[model samples]
Target: INCSFQNSVEFSQQVFVHTSGSPSFSSDELEIVEGSILGKHYKVEAFLGEGGFGIVAKCRDTTTNRAVAIKVNKSDPDILQQAHVEIFILEQLRRLDPDAANIVQWNGFFHDGERVCLKFELLDQCLWDYIRDRNKQGLPISEVRPILGQLTNALSHLSSVGIVHADLKPANIMVVNRHESPIKVKLIDFGLACPASAVMPGEFVGTVGYCAPEVMLGLPYNEASDMWSLGLVAVELATGVPLYPSENDYDYLKFIIETQGQPPDHVLDSGVYTEDYFIGD
Candidate 1:
């Protein structure tokens, strides 16, 4: 039986929609917490990055006195609700495989009256930044193998758990401890992720170039969609350039189709969708 409050919560969630809305960050009020909250303590340090859902910070946890990554959602109620949903989903993912070495570790989650904060393992550069930095310095391919392997392992594990990392761009894959012998690729940013069976076809839920063909066509997607994205990332790392940079969504879909050709017959026969939409590829 669906409780009235549960129904209200479900109704309140804004179903994922593809909007041309650019990302906006809250600049009105800044409440900086110098150290810890609840039982775990963290010294909120510097702003890492901001997104439509929240702002990530490089923080130092006082309890273990270890470096951490903190994502604090905007004060707006709508954004806060979205953060809750993200946390709820992530908590479930973490529970699914506590020892999923590829997945980023969730330290803890907290909320002050105004904002909800999520604490995660502090990692090194994102794949995009790492690639850019490498290109700038003319780094050798030998230095790139560990990063690539780690990411592949992460994606493989996520796929095994029936999770489709809808957004599998370089930006969402971070290299924790760049200097480590076998660098770890911690998959981050789940705001756009969804369970394989839960997401509907044609949701258009991913970044432009990294987005899959089905995403461009606004059709149902699955684990193969993520594999396509990872393949793109691997090619980009090999070539040092984005394979698909389309002008619009349609053009993007076309570009993917042109190069990769249409989805294989088996994929097309998945029965989740049957639209013959074509952009180019």
Candidate 2:
């Protein structure tokens, strides 16, 4: 099986083998072709992006003629479970605040055979790409301040609702209106998000470089973890470089120690995998 994107549209081409007693086409051979109709409402236009769990596409809503994003999950069971969780969290957030300007707008969800497709309001590029286009010179503090303020407010709102955006990074944040003076932004990609109280201690989550120390150490974490990520993002936006550009777990811990000093004995002791990196106390 192989996959590729053209014109921002996702297409999959598969080669299959046929047996004397079996069907020529297998379930995995099926794919959402470009220009295909989805949910009987969305007209697939272009592929937006893809991740380990799913692919995102730009589509048009036939009912409203509005541009939207459709996230189509792979047929893997774990990915399907995440898709369900994301949909549930978005629905709950919508119920809590119908007009959350700082968060991506979730239209609804539907299933395309075994695949789950989530519908969302299409927004502009992500902050990661936006910052890259700015020649990686880092944005002015004047601009960075506003983006941080809005993100802080969004995080606060999530905390109030007992939700934690486990994955908070530049790429997960969408820029709404880049041409405007005060650029508008919205948080997207809630696949790794979960209820603050539901997350078990030492659960691995979030992306590297942006992941919080507690998370990297496999310790219990909460909304504060997101704050840690936000702080790193702010620095990246201001300097166009990651504060801790470690390549792996050991290096990440080393960078943290070098920049912030060794963790307090208690913090190191609390980490489940501390002994792997640290010598005797």
Candidate 3:
């Protein structure tokens, strides 16, 4: 991994969320079920997962006889806006080869009734499930290394276009195939992702444990925030444990300071939320 960011070594570290915040969903909101045909040609096979934005389903394209994954948004205003943002980012990503960049391939988008749906190449198990399948013992350095390389490749591409994944962690990373000799992975889920320039203060993003210092400390989030997340993920893959497993920001910051030492003074001083984390020097 030729990760050449200036602070690549320092920055390293979702479920999934958007700026509007998660909303309560009634059962009827997401109406897709197995055998349901979406966009007329894609037949739903199974529900893959659900997150802040919408439900992901494994579907088969009847016309082409190919497996596909569709993320069906909840049709609510905020969800629709989030879908548009993700599609915008995905379009920006088209400049890079999805395979070489180690990013998920987006097929396109369509409307499933009033809801917005995104089509993508179907992928295998997420890293979290893979680790759990192994009884959470974690991967050896040999295995962890390749995954990191792939992820770094993914990040490098995102950086070129000034995109911040916002949520980067094991669950959001998917293995192309577990049996493949040298494992391959792709970055998934962009509901929380945004252009680095769009990042704003007081708008929370990403899972607490995997979130970066700038995000937690109320500073502007840049592409570097995603790198911080990648670092923590590198550790989790090798250790099978999160370095800062805390629901509280203060607790998480404390764990980070204990393990990595206090953040540089300028880092602390720049945070809008710095007062919450610091007292008199």
Candidate 4:
């Protein structure tokens, strides 16, 4: 599930070794070399990126010759189930808003005997890289406004459809091109997304710096949690620094308290681990 790039030989070796215990695929069938053709259509070109539970590769669609991203999930049952859920949510979103400008375009998914691969439109660099390239000077208000607006619209669309993009940060947002005027962006990476109404109690989600206070406290949350993350993203974009640059949960909570003040009495009372950090108030 490590998303870091590995050469084809290394990746193939890892996949085979990982799949050895599973009876789902043979070693030969699961071997995914750079030039290997998948699903009888797409040809894997190179490693694009990786995630905690998936490996994404840049691919070429034989029929269209268009570049696309194929995310190959680990051959684990729970991971496979999560991939299915992500595809289902994407399909529903596509049905609801086929022309949603800010959302990443999901093509389809197919199993390659060893893993489920989900195809999506290939996008440019992520906002984090973009910000880093600029030495983290942050974007001008005029530039940040458009990016924020698009992201806001995307979030609103997800909210309307009852989806919560549990993970939303600069890395999850991709710009179409670095040199493009207005810097059009698309939201990507839905690995942690889920139904807003179905969020389980005490289930922690999202990246640390961008995660909402309610999520950190294991309190019940909804789409508003995404908004809270978005607010942090906005500040990061404007200042080129994380609003909460903490390394752990305690420091993160301390950062929140220092900037936004202490949680309300009711929030502290309702938190699952309030006493773990807070003594009285």
Q: Which candidate comes out best when scored by TM-score?
A: 3
Cα lDDT, model 2, residue 59: 91
lDDT tens per residue, model 1, 55-141: 678887777778788887777766665565566557556654533547777865776556777778788888788778767443356
Q: Show where candidate 2 strays beyond 4 Å.
A: 1-30, 98-101
How far does residue 109 in candidate 2 sit from its true spot (Å)? 0.4
* Candidate 3 positional error at 223, Å: 1.3
Between prediction 1 and prediction 3, the one with superior TM-score is: 3
RMSD of each: 4.9, 9.8, 7.7, 8.6
Q: The CA-based lDDT of model 3 is what?
A: 0.81
Q: Against the unseen true structure, what C-alpha lDDT does each candidate score?
A: 0.67, 0.77, 0.81, 0.77
**Ranked candidates, highest lDDT first:** 3, 4, 2, 1
lDDT of 3 at 173: 96
lDDT score for residue 223 of model 4: 90
List, residue by residue over 178-215, the lDDT tens digit for candidate 4. Answer: 88897888888887777776776466777778888888
TM match of model 1 to true structure:
0.78
lDDT of 2 by residue, 1-281 (tens): 12111212121212111111111232224376678887788888988777666678899989989989998877777666566667656756874553364888887777787888888888889999999999999999888998999899889888888888888889899998788878888899888877776766666778778888887786888899999999999999999888888767788878888888888889889998778878852
Best-first order by TM-score: 3, 2, 4, 1
Report the Cα lDDT for candidate 2: 0.77
**TM-scores of the models, in the order given:** 0.78, 0.86, 0.87, 0.85
TM-score of 3: 0.87
lDDT of 3 at 108: 78
> Residue 32: error of model 4 in Å?
3.9
How close to the true structure is residue 164 of candidate 3, measured as C-alpha lDDT? 91
